[model samples]
Target chain A: MSELIRDFARLPQTWFETPIAAIALTLAAYFVGVRLFKLMRHPSWFPPVVIAALLIAAVIALLPIGVEDYNRGAAWLTLLLGPATVALAVPLYQQLPQIRALWRPILMTLPLSATLAACYALLIAWAMGAPPEVLASLAPKSVTSPIALSLTEELGGSTALLMGALMVTGITAIFGVEWLSRWLKIRDPRLIGLALGINGHALGTVRAFEISHQAGAFASLGMSLTGAFTAVVLPVVWHLFV
Target chain B: MSIMRGLLWLLAFLLLGQSMVQLLPIPLPAGVVGMLLLTLWFVRRGKMNADVVAVSHPLIAMLALLIMPGVVEIFFVAGRYADQAGAILTALLVGTLLSVASSLWLMRRYMPPLNETDHE
Candidate 1:
């Protein structure tokens, strides 16, 4: 077994050198993760994203290829993040009437929540003695990746660190918010979705959509509005303070 | 063909968004601006076409997979931030929880009571 494993590892990289290999590997891992998730009855402990990322990370770690090479191969898929974000409008469109009715509450809450998210991240990181770059990267942690990466880049922070923090924040909200909502006895899907969106961003929106269409719509709204709010406000505040 | 059209529309919106982000002085992201623009267009039309819906549903469904590459990049740079990894992780956890709790509280406080039809 050891010999086979070593031989497999030593095999020429030619076999997995193409972009298709990277894309195919990602899809394959995601499907396997999905299967594992279902086989385990959708346990939160083994969310597909978590599993797929870890599996791909492990494979990339063991292989001779660098992260940049893998990303270049996978760039085709990542490019879709733009369209995927725009696609969020579909749900938002579906929920337009509801949103119109609740626009007051949404508009009122979005900026406040956005500010709070940034402040909490910055203050907590500062108190923990995190470097300024880390704090800046974290300030936009609740925004989705593309926007968060852009914001972090503009602020001269590490996009890689921000990406990791964004995922952690998202996964934490996904796993914990439902229980917290339940504990608080918050029954409205709108509120629940809003909370998920503001706190979790894209991943949280995915989870919200799983719960119901209404929840998904509100989550989309929350995510977009929060992204816009953070983009406009965080830079101004960061400039003033740090 | 409908999916193709939908893709084209999405691509056009994406292009417009990117251009606007560059041209504008405000700090808005292209994606968010695109979403807002799309939403406004839909609102003006007062309905979503089937083709748009067809394209968007699948795209949105696979969003997590789309973001996996970025997440995977984290593993490569994880060691670089090892000194502050503990602090970063703690801030992420605590800050996320606080954000979630506060947002939920505020939404609950301000959200109006749902009408009977809204429960549907």
Candidate 2:
């Protein structure tokens, strides 16, 4: 058969079309990203997640496989996000001591910080003439990726757009937290880490860990609570008005 | 804690959370609800099960890879974002900075400085 006889470079499209291939490729790319991240000594701006996405993009560009085809395998991974999100309880549990210790500050800071995070993003985007869909995508910008992606889906926002906003938010929060904390003269690692977590989510948590174990603990707490709070409250509030 | 047992526990909780969403009038996603319930479970026990931790560790760690499909959606939807990238970037930058500032201010201004030894 001509198909079996084809040269390596001229392989059939169907050979690249299997779900196993798609999953394998995705895993391989992500593995490559992790290796690269470690090799580079773990730069903040160049996360393995971002790197893997770019690699996947290159593969897509070079091949005839479209998103629909790739997603046949990836859809299972996406579905896994639900349980993965549920698994956020582990970090929250691990931070229980720190959470109990500073319940007051955590509580006082939560409603305002979480509300402002959503409002500022939405309002600013709205003012800048971003359409309603764009606003939806941006509404959960401060949330961690899993929660944000699910919320964006509920609101009919583009998850792709939300991902971009997430990267920007994470990068901005990482850079801005240092300057902001210095200006506020807040020497408390707990508060600084909480601010970082609430605004920046997982990336912020990683950065917080770099600051100190205490900061890292509080950051995980902050990231988890903000995620749950925004996820629960945003949908209710979103439906009420828009 | 074998991985199988750990996953079973996680899935059971996940089921509980999803059921709550369907039974109640909450607009929140099942995953968020599940996360809350599981936290509460951990609180009640005042400690974590090794099994749950075992399963959750990998799931959370692999999260970056899990969400890659969503990010790649940009390849298809770039047309929608082509005109507004600047506004979006500016909004994210300013919004994130202001958020960090306000949260830090609120905590420092309102939260009485508790000595580190107080919690013990």
Q: Fnat of each prediction?
A: 0.78, 0.68
Give, for candidate 1 chain A, the lowest lDDT window spanning 10 residues: A9-18
* Candidate lDDT (C-alpha), each: 0.84, 0.79
**All DockQ scores:** 0.69, 0.60
Candidate 2 lDDT, B30-80, residue by residue in tens: 776788799899899888888888888788767667766667757666777
Predicted structure 1: lDDT: 0.84
Per-residue alpha-carbon lDDT of model 1 for A136-193, expressed as tens digits?
A: 7888899988778888998989988888888898888877688788989988888888
lDDT tens per residue, model 2, A131-227: 8889889999989886788899989898788887887787788778887778777788878788888998877776786687677667767887788
Which prediction has the highest lDDT against the true structure?
Answer: 1
Check candidate 1 and list the clashing pairs. Answer: none
